[model samples]
Target: MTSTPPLRQQCPPGACDCHRERLLENPDADLRILLLTRNEEQRLLERLENLKDLADLQRMQQKLQEQLGIRLHIAPGFNEVRTTRGIEFDFEDQPGLCRKTRQAIPAAIRRSMEKNPEIAWRLLDSHDLLGGL
Candidate 1:
């Protein structure tokens, strides 16, 4: 006996489903932008400074996701990875450094990390960045 494949929803014949499908394809499109003002940067750094352990950092990551819709990954001791739409905090070797992959990071984040190397170092240590990735 032959099994049938799962049925898929079909768009109406005359309707243009391209737009709808595109939107559905990338629901996180809106979350692609990471914008933070200087004051906002200061506030975020202050919060990061207060974190006590990996668990606290994880909670902060969740808060960041909920508030800013950005995904934060903390990989200790790994070289920073950046993308056109993503910013990686490089605290492995040099703290408070913003390195880009294809495009430049947002101005605010760049300034924040550049200005607060010690805080960035603290963040790395909190996440055990020095130990391993």
Candidate 2:
């Protein structure tokens, strides 16, 4: 007799229903905190440390719920964007924190700029102002 795969194992529970619900939901209804930065190795560790703080997490959670009308969760993960000189940091959980961190990128860049004045000035000069606009 040939062995057959279990149905439950083959098709997990809530797969169809949950995916359907998520599809029906608004695209922007879910909040995504993306961290786009250059020279990630220098700042990744420090940024992760800041994110692990309790006060920062709480504040971020509150902001997501209040501003985006979506519940937030925080997970630790990062991705590299192709064709770009930067890394995109992604938080699966604590989206609020991610959003806040995204906002703080400029400040962080400024701080880094102070330390490496030469590279900072070069970056500032080379950045495309019109691209963002």
Candidate 3:
């Protein structure tokens, strides 16, 4: 008998990469962004500074998701796609499909820090860029 295909589609490129990296780097941990929102930049920084083990982070993430009814999905192709009409914070990273998706945002951020600080932090963290810190 032939097997049926899975109901869900393959995750976008960067989504899997991010999730894989997180797992490989910390087998049971999650990231801080999963618990915070754009308006909570200060809180996010604080959490990042005090970030502990993976299990702790996982608990924090779970609590935040439960409390806020939101969850952070780490998959390969699912990146925060930015386009002419504002950024789709959860858009998948598809080549040629989203020209502005997953592209650099540091310079744009530097040009106007106040306008994109929170989003910039999210993107910067995702790219594993801590150089400016």
- Give the number of the best model, judged by TM-score: 1
- Give the Å error, residue 129, model 3: 22
For model 2, give the 10-residue run with minimal summed lDDT. 5-14
Question: Please, what are the lDDT tens digits per residue for candidate 1 over residues 97-124?
Answer: 2232111223334344455544356556
**For model 3, how does the per-residue alpha-carbon lDDT over 1-133 read when each residue is reduced to its tens digit?**
9984222222467654334334336645433323333335344334533434334334644664565333433321344434312322232322221122122222222333234345444444555654556
Off by over 4 Å in 2: 1-24, 27-99, 127-133
Return the top candidate by lDDT: 1
Give residue 74's error in model 3 in angstroms: 3.5
C-alpha lDDT (0 to 100) for residue 87 of candidate 1 = 33
As for lDDT, the candidate ahead, 1 or 2, is 1
Q: What is the TM-score of each candidate against the true structure?
A: 0.36, 0.26, 0.26
| RMSD in order of candidates | 14.4, 16.8, 14.9
Model 2 Cα lDDT, one tens digit per residue, 1-133: 9984221111144332223234325576343322222233235435533443334444645764564333544322234322112322233343223333443443443344345554333332344422443
Q: Against the correct fold, how does model 2 do in TM-score?
A: 0.26
lDDT (Cα, 0-100) at 28 in candidate 1: 58
Give the Cα RMSD of candidate 3.
14.9
**Candidate 3 structure, TM-score to reference:** 0.26
Please list the residue runs of candidate 3 whose C-alpha ends up more than 4 Å from where it truly belongs after superposition.
Answer: 1-41, 75-133
> For model 2, what is the C-alpha lDDT against the true structure?
0.37
